[model samples]
Target: MQTPRDFTELSMISKTRWQDEELQYFQHALSQILPYINSEGLTILHEINKEIYTRAEKQDSQYT
Candidate 1:
């Protein structure tokens, strides 16, 4: 189970730039804790996923 502090940290982290490795770490962490989190956490998870997808799109565009 994740603590409220964990969610707070994640929320703060979500607002900043992330290296690919760090993003992957949090992505996995969030998925693992999904079943245990509240609706607010779910919202944060969606935000993280959106960030990941957005970054991927940017990287892909650079290669095109």
Candidate 2:
């Protein structure tokens, strides 16, 4: 398992990543799915994001 110190030791980003660049990666990550889904469907990704964060927080609390 990676320790908190291990992650803290990572270097800072060399360059600022633009919003479009981040969205491009986000879109590309979903490329395997059908193109029919619209922005409405994308909103649910936020819920999924929240759930993952919540679970991560729970795990972190247990560890800490």
Per-residue lDDT for 1-64 in model 1, tens only? 3223444455566444655665566678879999999998787778778888988899899999
Off by over 4 Å in 2: 1-31, 34-36
Question: Clash pairs of candidate 2?
Answer: none
The candidate that wins on lDDT is 1
User: For residue 51, what is the lDDT in candidate 2?
Assistant: 48
Candidate 2 per-residue lDDT over residues 13-32, each given as its tens digit: 21122233443333444454
- Candidate 2: residue 57 Cα off by (Å): 1.0
**RMSD value for candidate 1:** 5.1
At residue 20, give the lDDT of candidate 2. 31
How close to the true structure is residue 4 of candidate 1, measured as C-alpha lDDT? 30
